[model samples]
Target: MTPFWKLSAAGFAATAIAYGPARMGFGLFLPEFRSVFSISLQAAGFISSLGFFGFFVGLLISQFLTARRGPRPPIVLGLAAATTGMSLVAVASNLTVLSLGVLLAMLSAGFSWTPFSDAINRQVEERLRPVSLSLVSTGTGLGIVAAGAAALLMSIGGVSWRLCWALFAVGSAFALLCNWIALSGAGEASGVRRPLRWQALFRRATTPIFAIGLCYGVTSTVYISFAADRIAQAGGVPGLPANLSGSLVFICYGAFGLLGLVTGQIKTLTGLPWLLRLLLLASALSSVLIALAPASWAGVVVSAGLQGINVMMTSAVLAFWSDRLFPAFPSRGFTAVLLAVATGSVLGPVAAGSFASHFGVTAMFLATAALAASAALAIRSGYISETPHPE
Candidate 1:
């Protein structure tokens, strides 16, 4: 395979495991998990918050590891962490074990995501880099679709959650081996490594983008964590079985994955600035749809599809922005945005769940819609710029 395709293929599979199963699977499996563990909504939210805490810790340390040893070691270590973490979750006996498993799995996304930019920058030709990276990102959608499909089967066949986690782990292990070989073939950087710098973390241009990421962190995480439960509570697709909402999460993911394939083309058409703006608006609309879906079953399906596309667009655009801002130190830019994302992810569920415990999910989503609109305004008002400014 061509080098660009090699890395793209590897990155795609790894992301599916890292983001789809190891990390995002928590939200997808919340119903079965909470029932099996007798977890309260607040407890579930707290667990999700704890996972992001692990993600934050990993995000902090990955750059240090990457700075000293390039991107290869950390990527491999992350895949290992994911594989072990999912295995642990599959057989977990208590809430503590499950949380630990989730934490480890969540760590995988942090470890795997940043290095790819550096890798692609190294391996893929400049002209093909954007398209290649976009293609790799669709892996998250694929992972989501896979997870959703698994859940669909489980819902249909009455399979155990234990099986779900085990399958996710087994698949991750296979993907890990492929990712390791692919990354290894990309070869290590040859020059003396640049010393990790603190100043670049605070460049003026990154601030707005980081804030936008923060909004995504808060709203999107909450939606992922609680939206399904909300659908179930609201009586789930009106005509369909209530138990199938979990399965539908996969459908949403499938839609996301399929739509995500066009990210490169979409970026090429809209360009970054307009694309970011449109995504913010699209996000706001999606949130509104989620908030209102209880009244109309058709809205549930539409909301899920929109959410999938909006998220892929946002993540793709963010990755593009990070690479543009920090050509040599792309990881640092990614690190900054991730830290922002981590903070929002950490806080989002805790706050949204607490508010939901009082005002309910509908209210929570409307509040999120407000935040998404604020993000759009922030972008429109010049917090995020189209051009990269030198540090």
Candidate 2:
């Protein structure tokens, strides 16, 4: 593989590894945390939501910092913060400390992920960018699988969840070290320019992009937040032995990345909007399947896989759209999309959790399916049409 490919792969791996513990692993460890901290379920959920909140704040900060200093410093700083945060969580004994740790970890993750993506977008050739991005996204799946395996192993070894987090922290530190080495000589000096106001970009193509992004974000957030729990519940998998469920979720995500590659090629062959519609339909169908699945492991796995494909396809398609819409400002456009993702992440979990708390997991799945369906309609109606540049 070429140096760019190697860097992309390394970057992807770092992202996946860092987020595995912070995002997916946290849910797996939630029960154990509750026991240790003596917190209520609602409180625990609130704490997890705090991480997302921090992520939002971090993204905003990253935009300004990256604009001024370019992306490297924030990326490095974010990775360092995430490493420390995860370590703090591993040793945290109180709810306040744990919450703070999670917050910091998420903030670091957001900072690292966005700037790294910006760097990749800046450095890589245009045509190869999507493939490289899809490859990078595969890291998320890999990390989730690793987290699940770790959870299972820890359970089998009679180790505490805290210990698992500590181990994950050690791994994250190693990942951070590797990223530092790989990216050390890769930093760019910021070009001198007047900083553009956020509103300048926001007011231009902002409404439609954010509108579409909101729908996409909500769907993604809901799916990620509750997919594992739903699978475990549906499959009757024990909470402690969560390997199969976690692995299944990650596998689904990986499959989705593969699907993204395939679909991206198809978009090149056919058209992007058409491909997006297909993804939306798939996502909607996946949700319904999850909602109606029998209490069997196979049913859960199948649903998870479908959800994975749906999400990956949606992301890939939207990314293509962003590239087309904002050819001059890929990072800014992508960040706009991410802002929507963050919004969805915030709303999805809270909404799903509410539905789960009041009704059941199935209802949450159904609601998410509706959201996916609505987004498909929005795309079809040309709410996200590309504007023609002045002749």
In candidate 1 the C-alpha lDDT for residue 151 amounts to 75
* 266: Cα error in model 2, Å: 3.0
Off by over 4 Å in 2: 1-6, 34-41, 117-134, 200-208, 233-247, 387-391
Instruction: Provide the overall lDDT of each model, using Cα atoms, as 2-decimal numbers.
Output: 0.79, 0.67
Best by TM-score: 1
lDDT of 1: 0.79
> Clashing pairs in model 2?
none
**TM-score of each prediction:** 0.91, 0.85
Tens-place lDDT digits, model 2, residues 1-391: 5546765866786777655666655665654665578755346456666777777777878877888777767776776777788888888978878988888877765676666666666677788776676667667666766776777676677877778878877877777777777666556745766455345456544466677677766676566555655555555444434434544555555444455557667877757566666677777777777678634566656666676677666666666677666666666667777777777666666666766678777777788888878777766435546663111
